[model samples]
Target: MEMEKTTDPTSFHGAYRMTPATFDELLALVGPHIVKQTTNFRDPVGVSERLGITLRYLATDMSQRDVARHFCVGRATVCKIIQEVCQAIWEVGAPLFMAKPTTEDWKKIAEEFNNQWNFPHCLGAVDGKHIHIQKPALSGSLYFNYKRTFSTILMGVADAAYRFIYLDVGSYGREHDGSVFAQSTFGKALEDGTLLLPQSPNGDLPYVFVGDEAFPLKPQLMRPYPGKNLSDKKKIFNYRLSRARRVVENAFGIMVSKWRILRQPIIAKPEKVDKIVKAIGVLHNFMREKEGLEVECDVGSESGMTDVQIRLGANMYSGAAWDIRENFANHFSSPQGSLPYQNDIVQRGLNI
Candidate 1:
């Protein structure tokens, strides 16, 4: 005989795949928005239950069918609940967690970069991730990536601490990182100087985002020198810049680790999967703040110097952007800003 459905929250939370405290905290945050009007003794599945249902699916990579079986709801009901609760979570969580900070906040981030990563005048790090998903019907090769898998792009900016500052998700995976970034609104904002970035401490420097070679170099952006034939100063500069970019790498790792749904190929339509990915991003910040949860990605933080980021060769800009990069590179090798190891590396003539 089949066993009766358990109603105990302690047991439910174990199945929910997060701590009881975190589950309760999440329910309290978004329960009002997702709460259903029709609930009684026979229909005990309320807002909190549906919230738990959705969170369980996210945390465990469980299918909607499995979630429905566990939650004692129909598959259609489960699907509706997931979308509804996800929307609620984004509405309640985005402004608080994903919203851009003030100039003062940016200053703190730059200060952290100076203290921790030894990269000064840095604002944030940018990177792109491919969210794997099943191919949609009648949509031939639209989502096929170079890796021969289907996915959507999740391009994001993270600060020194791996907190997401901006995100643009749901782009077709066929587009390369450079093109995706070029088309992103954040990239446009950076180019247009519409973002209120924190001013340099001494006012002579421009605050900038650190990215891999996948991104084009700009006055407000920094990328390492191309080619294996590099100098010690170039090596040191590359290392310093890579170290700063680790925050975004770690953030993605922690996110995928915690929300295992992203680990496997998500099975859903692109429209629904978009909502799921976005909700995951928002909830990542929520769970991170509430639980102080940060687990590094199993593969470790990537330097992005690999072949994937090395494409879209050699772009020349007709302006001072190139000059600014030269200035930073020169300053990195100068006595005023050069680190001891940097000098040692230069002295040893080692290429990093």
Candidate 2:
């Protein structure tokens, strides 16, 4: 309470990662569910306080005990409050922030990819990252990843605006992106052709999601051509695809940069961590949408450009998928579809 009274607006945002107005808006939405009944025994914690505690925990690496101290509450109470409030936030915010896109929505996303990323007919960018966690009890190697960390995988699809179109959490970290994606509900829908996507006019080329070498190349999914000795046209296609696909990477970057809880290893069970991760993802979309955030990709070392490679045999990608990729590659180098700066970027990549 003293801190609240004394802290300036910048300090408040640094603490909670949102403006007072935004906090009030969020409190109004999730307040009812988290509000406690005033019993004769004692008055319960206020809704604003409950939400504030949770936000501070997420925005920083503070432990529940530390958060409890900061909020003048018991550690056990802080734990319960964080869990309950996170669940309430997800329940209230997920539908609005993470709603599955319709055909029209997909079309708009593709249009944005074309306009902003210069990658036409691109629906979204897909990738997965390992989220570190404590090793679960009696679980041998289930959560252990190649990075030798006990973690879970967070697979996401981000549109050109860097908003997550879909998120799948809680996959075992031992699994790679491709395997996790292949097993995901969203991936299954895409494979089954049941996922809502905008129809192509000619019916020859379908809208595609740009991924990296870690993912399989499909008619619906486009990946960079594997190998160093690529032609200028293929290099241009790669540069364009990487430009678009980097949105997901930057989305993750912004999310982790803003919500520092994800940067440290979460000390919780896998089930609890799943809720926390989902809550964070939902909150990420909410903040990005409400804030009108910019999508900025890193201009760092080109070495950071390529994603983790898991060897996918050439035979795994169908001929039709190859043809689609070729078409995109050719178009990216053509006068009608080429960008003025694409060649320069491709050359820089090659020199690097």
For candidate 1, write residues 292-332 as lDDT tens digits.
65433443433221112335552645467777777777777
lDDT of each: 0.76, 0.83
Question: Candidate 2's residue-wise lDDT over 1-352, tens digit each?
Answer: 2125224877888898887888888988998899888898877888889989989999898998899998888998988888899898888889999998999999999999999988888999999888888899999999887767788888999988778889998888787778888899999999898888878884445799988888988999999987888888988888888889888988887788778888778888998888888898898899987875633322221211123326456237899999999988888888998989878878887421
Compared with the true structure, model 1 gives a TM-score of: 0.88
The Cα error of candidate 1 at residue 19, in Å, is 2.5
Quote the lDDT for 37 in model 2.
Answer: 85
Best by lDDT: 2
* lDDT minimum window of 10 residues, candidate 1: 301-310
The residue-level lDDT of candidate 2 at 134 comes to: 89
Assess the local accuracy of residue 56 in candidate 2 as a C-alpha lDDT between 0 and 100. 95
Q: Which candidate is the best by TM-score?
A: 2
Instruction: State in Å the error of residue 309, model 1.
Output: 6.2
Model 2: lowest-lDDT 10 consecutive positions: 297-306
Query: How many Å off is the CA of 9 in candidate 2?
Result: 0.8
